[model samples]
Target: MKAPALEQRKLLDLQAADNRIAQLQHTLRTLPQEVRLAELQRDSVAARQEFGGVNGELEDARAEIARVEADIDTVAAREKRDRERLQASSSSKDIQGLEHELASLKVRRSNLEDIELAVMERVEEIEQRLAAITARRDDIATEERLLAAQRDEQRDRVAAQLEVAKSERSAIAGGIGAELLALYERQRERYGVGAALLQGGVSLGTNVALTESDLAQIRAAAPDEVVLDPDGACILVRTEESGL
Candidate 1:
């Protein structure tokens, strides 16, 4: 198709705007904030798991301490009953038996006290662990929130830039003839680059390494003209040099 010279120049601007839009899209997809937010979310989940485990352990420890204390109270009550029974005994053999039972009760009470001490120590340790885990979880939650906000802002900015780039690309494309624009769009879908400048006789399109025939065709085209073919090749002439 024979587009006017002015329309042909607009093709270059269209190509540039399209490239800019593509770059913006790439930046949006691969933003550092995207990766960071993913990692932060993972960490937050892990922190929550840790906090849950710690809380469960603390609860278990507390329950265990309560159980041990109850057992101690029961044992002390039995010892008191045994002492009262000893005081009421009158026979020598009975007195002897009562003294032996009282000695055993003392040993049992010592053992219960030891167990209670150990349980208390465990409770203290669990409390400390729960506190630490809760603090860390809170910190991670805060960081996740901050990162999410920053990521949202970054996404908004990228979206705005994308809209602007799209508008610019559309305006430039509007300046070209419909046939040329259609050809360019088709080539872009096939090759990822709609048109490339014939610089130094080289047809460069989104890192498209040109074949010999492609190079020859570009070299043969008149300056400042757009060329298209069915093989998804689109070239814009810029110079007579045959080696670009």
Candidate 2:
């Protein structure tokens, strides 16, 4: 394929733009902030599980407190009934039995109150623990949001740069002949570089010095003639610096 030497040089710009596009795409896929965000998301899941277990304990503690309180109420009511019977009964034996029964009720009420107090304390402890966990969860969420925002901002910046690069590539590519552009695209698709400078008898695509025979052959080609390097990796565009 024949393209003016100057037009061939534009392939380098296209190649550079293509490289930047690939790099930006890679950055989008493997952002450092995204990695951290993923970790934070996992941490959030674990934190929620921990909080759920602690909350279950809290619910159990509260239920126990309710049960204890009910028992204390029942005991107190029994004591009141026993006292009323004592005041009404004149028989000494009856009074003694009623007073003894009342004493037992008092002890029962005391025990129930103690149990209620302990359960209440347990609830308080669980609540405190839950609060701390909740605070930590909030902190994690805050950080996740911040990281997400940072990641988005970075993506936007890179996206803008990528658009610019694409526009630049499109403008350069439009000026090239269809046959040459097709050949360059094909080479790039196969070997990653569409064009490279043959500087000082070297193929910059591979950064390898071409043999004397290879340079001799390239020098024989017309200036507007597109030629591939010996390795066929890319079109080797020569200039005065190529030392041909």
Candidate 3:
């Protein structure tokens, strides 16, 4: 393979751009906000379940309270009717029976009121729990929105960087001759080494120095010539810094 020394140097820039693209792609795939969003989904489900349970219990408590109040009203009405009958009747036996029935109704009404009070207290507790659960859900939603906004912003920045890198690589590739470009691409695809700097008799690709015979061979080649290191990993580009 033969390429001008100047053309060979541009391979470093192309390689760097390719590395930038790879890095940006990796960032897009592993954003931290994505992981947090997944966890929030699970948290949302658990919160919903707890809220449903508490709400159902509150409803049951309300129904129980209504039933108790109804029972109290019925007992009060029965006592009023008994009192009316006792005042109108002159018979002693009827008056005595009415008094006993009225006494029983008062006891039943008192028990129903107690039951209603207890159930109202329970309903208040359940309502407090539901309010707490609702507040937690709101917090989670707010966090999710914030994280999502951050994720989108980061993704846009990374995507823009990737586009710029690809454009730079394209511009560099356009300047190189077809034969040289093909050779560089082939070496890169085959061994992940497209070009290496030949400095002080060393190939940067493998970070190894050449032997006496190998140095002699490269020294004999033309200044415009392109050569590979003994390891044959990459095209070695030389300059005054090569210390030839």
Best by lDDT: 2
Candidate that beats the other on TM-score, 1 or 2, i.e. the better one: 2
- RMSD per model, one decimal: 3.3, 1.5, 3.3
Give the per-residue lDDT of model 1 (tens digit) for 14-132: 88898899999998888777777688788878878887887888788778878877887887887788788888878788889878887887888788789879878987988888788
Query: Which tens-of-lDDT digit does each residue in 7-48 have in candidate 2?
Result: 888887778888888898888788889889988999999899
Model 1 residue 87 distance off true place after TM-score fit, in angstroms: 3.6
Model 3 misplacement above 4 A: 186-244
**Positional deviation of residue 131's Cα in model 3 after best superposition, in angstroms:** 1.3
Q: Which residue pairs show collisions in model 1?
A: 200-244, 202-244
The Cα RMSD in angstroms, rounded to one decimal, for candidate 3 relative to the true structure is: 3.3
Which candidate achieves the best TM-score against the true structure? 2
Error of 2 at 243 (Å): 2.5
| TM-score of each predicted structure versus truth | 0.84, 0.94, 0.79
lDDT preference between candidates 1 and 3, better one: 3
Predicted structure 3: lDDT: 0.86
lDDT for position 88 in model 3: 100
